[model samples]
Target chain A: MKVAVIQFPGSNCDQDALYSLREDIGVAAEYVWHDSTSLVGFNAVFVPGGFTYGDYLRCGAMAATAPVMDEVRRFAREGRPVVGVCNGFQILCESHILPGALMQNVNQKFLGQDCYLKAINRTSPWTERVEGVVRIPIAHMEGRYVADAETLARLEGDGLVAFRYVSPTGELSEEWNPNGATNAIAGIVNDKGNVLGMMPHPERATRKLLGCDDGLAIMSAFRLLPVN
Target chain B: MVTVRVFVNLKPSLLDSAGRTVTGALHKLQFDEVADARIGKTITLQMEKFDEERVKAMCAKLLANPVIEDYSYEVLN
Candidate 1:
């Protein structure tokens, strides 16, 4: 399977994602510049992390309106897998393809550490077959997930929540939440379950040398899924 | 020429950590009268035409995220 990893200005993790997907996960992946307007050949799209547009006007705000996003939105509408990590998550939220907004961390600090994430939804293409808790590193200043009460209720009722911050023992608790995300949400999928937005850097954890390879399961799930 | 000034802020239901931090500093400086603080951004745009509706659309579409923030604009010529 082929994947497209979008590269916006100030995106630092594009290579990491490409390496993880292409080299480690054994899928054909290429970098798609943000200015490009098409995503025709790729079956899957990955939005990697970084301070897109220098995090100006709000993180991922400007990058969300890039020319290529229109095509990304269309690609998502086709029911293909689209995963956004870190600032990519912010961009997805800014693009309104995903629900809610990421706010400044409740602690008002940038957190760069490994955290445990519970797989809340095992049916989505990104999380299917992934078992139990996974450890991933998150590096961001604004990763707090929030939405209005009604939207939050709908997300919960629909089982759209893809992941949640949890203790190592797999218990959900505010203390284990690094960013104070609502409901300890670490990631979520759209109503259709094709689009996923999460703050953690799964690509960075795809290799044993990186201290963990649990993230590889996520990428593998996307690679293994049949093209739509 | 027309200029539009837009103000965008997080909704009251959301916690404003930056604003709270600023309020804490203010209280420490003996500004105890400050009971609550909210932080927001003001974006100034220069335009050739002044249309209230267009400006509102601009704010709604790109200048502010409707999910967590509210926005207002003033047109000046």
Candidate 2:
């Protein structure tokens, strides 16, 4: 199935996502400009990471209102796969397509580093094949995730957490968290389990030549999404 | 025409990390009287007419993220 990689003006990771999807995963994926209002031919959508709209107003705020986001919202409504990475994640939250918000990192710095993550909810189609500590790079100024107490409880109770920061040994601890995200969360799935959002750049770590292949497992989930 | 000003701030329950950095900077500047610091932004709009309902809607829809922030606005007549 073909994938639609939504491209905003400031998106820098669209090419990386295309490369991983086409070269590594052997999926047909192409860029769809931000102003586009259609996703008819694509079965899945990917919102890649970048400082969209130069991060004006707030990270992802302007980009969330981009025309393509309406289609992204519609696509997600159709029970299809939608994965937003880094700034994409922020956009999703800003658009209310995802719960919670990505706040300034606890340290108030743009952190860029490889961090370990464990699949907290492997049942999701987005992370079902991903196992163990999946090392991926996170690059963002506002990557810390926060949600109200009621929403947090629902997420925890419903197994909506797709992944969580963890030590090499899969131990959850503050020391393993680089962004101070709530409950060490690295990624989360929508209630329908079709939409996934996370700050880590799985697209950047998808191949062996890139110095790591752990991201392949994550991509594989998107590639081999079940035909339900 | 009237002007409406909106203020947005992170919820008090959340850690204002940038605010904390400002506090640290202030401490280093010898402003020891500062207990804590919080940061927020203000936006002003010049409109043909001031509609409180529309302004609140704008705040909820775009000016602020209710998940992490709160917003209030005042009209300048």
Candidate 3:
């Protein structure tokens, strides 16, 4: 199976994403430029985290308007797998491929630390291998996920709640929340479950050098999808 | 000419932690009268004619996120 990692002008994690997927996970992944229109043959797409367009105006606001987002939308509609990390997540939300907008952190400060995440729904192919609670590293100044009441209810009702934050002990309670969001939501899937967006940088936690083991479990979720 | 104004905000279900913190700070400063606080954005664009669908598409495509935020544009002529 081929995995395509999108490379925007300012994407800093392309190498790391590529390294983790090809070297660590032993997957055949290629880098796709942000201006490309076609996304054929690739089974999955990864919008890695970084400051796209110098983060001018808003975080992902500029990148969302990029020329290639049209294909991103089409791929999402075709029930293909897409994951957005950090600023990538912002772009996806900006493109309306996922639910909710990521707002500034509650403290208005850039947070760079390891945190825990609970797999709220494992039904999706993206979460099938990850069970219970795991840890991932989150690094961003704007990572708060926000949505309206009715829309939030719809997401929950549709089993779109993918991953939430909790204590390292795996206690699925509100007290374990590291970030500021309802029920400490760290990640969520779109209505179709083909798109996954999360604040935590799984690419950052893939190696022991990064000081976390949570990323392995998260990436393993991709293996459940038949490699083609 | 038509002027379109777009309003964007976080959904009610999504927590406005930043707004909450600001409200908390205000309360700490003895501003208890502040019932609630929320943060959002607004933009205005001038166009030749008003098309609700096109305007909605613009908002959906760039101005605002339909998933986390709902936006409505007022047409002024």
Candidate 4:
């Protein structure tokens, strides 16, 4: 099955995603421009991270309305894996494919550093094989996640949460909550479990030579699913 | 001609991080009278006629994120 790496005007992580999916996961992948309106032969889609539309109106707001998002929406509806990372996560939320919104960091500073994550929704295809804490780097000015009380409750109750920031030993604390995301969430899946949105850069950590490969399991999960 | 102005801001329950930072700077400047600060944005749209329904749709669809933000608009002709 081919993986379609969706690329927006300002997307910078498209190459990395393509490389990881090809070299690391051993899959067929190619770039799909934002103006494109189809994902015909692709079984999985990846919305890479970057400052799409120069972050106009709001981060991910403009890109969310792009033509390619329509195709991504189609894929999500059919239960195909659609992974959105970092800025891609913002775009998916803006497109209403995912719940909640990402806001400015509580500290009001751009963060570029390694973050630890723990799988919260272990039964989904996105997190089923993920075990223990995973180290991934995050680079964003607006990464804090916000949702209403009822939504948060529903996500938690429904087991839609994918990952949460935590300490090395899997402990939650203020120090590890880099952006003050509610429940220290780092990632979450849609109700159908086909759309996954997260604030960390998993593509950057696919090789152990790059310092950490904990993200490989997460990023490679798309191939593990049968495209159902 | 009609001019529509949209104001968007985080909900009151959510923390305005940038506004808090600005408030800290103001306190450092000895502006103790400023009890608090909240930051928001204003977007203006130009249209041939004031269409309240269209403006509402725009606000709901793009200008503001209903999840964490609230929006208000005014029309001037």
Worst 10 residues of 4 chain B by lDDT: B68-77
CA lDDT of every candidate: 0.91, 0.91, 0.80, 0.91
- After superposition, candidate 3 runs with Cα above 4 Å error: A173-175, B1-57, B66-77
lDDT of 1: 0.91
Q: Which CAPRI level is candidate 4?
A: high
Error of 2 at B58 (Å): 0.5
Q: Which clashing pairs does model 1 show?
A: none
2 or 3, greater by lDDT: 2
State the lDDT of candidate 3 residue by residue for A1-228, as single tens digits: 678899988998888888888876778889999988887888888899999989875678888877778888887998888889888898898877886778777667888887887787887776767867667888888887777777779878887888888888887776665557665778889877889998888877777776875687767555557754
Which parts of model 4 have CA positions greater than 4 angstroms off?
none
Shift in Å, residue A37, candidate 1? 1.1
Positional deviation of residue B41's Cα in model 3 after best superposition, in angstroms: 4.4
lDDT by residue (A1-228, candidate 4, tens digit) is 689999899999999999999998778899999999988888999999999999998899999999989999988888888999999999999999999999999888999999999999987787887899889999998999989999999999999989999998899987999999998989999998889999999889989888999888887786677853
Pairs with backbone N, CA or C atoms under 3 Å apart (clashes), candidate 3: A147-B11, A148-B11, A148-B12
Model 4 chain A scores worst on lDDT over the 10 consecutive residues at: A219-228
Model 4, A145: alpha-carbon shift in Å?
0.7
TM-score of 3: 0.81
lDDT of 2 at A51: 92
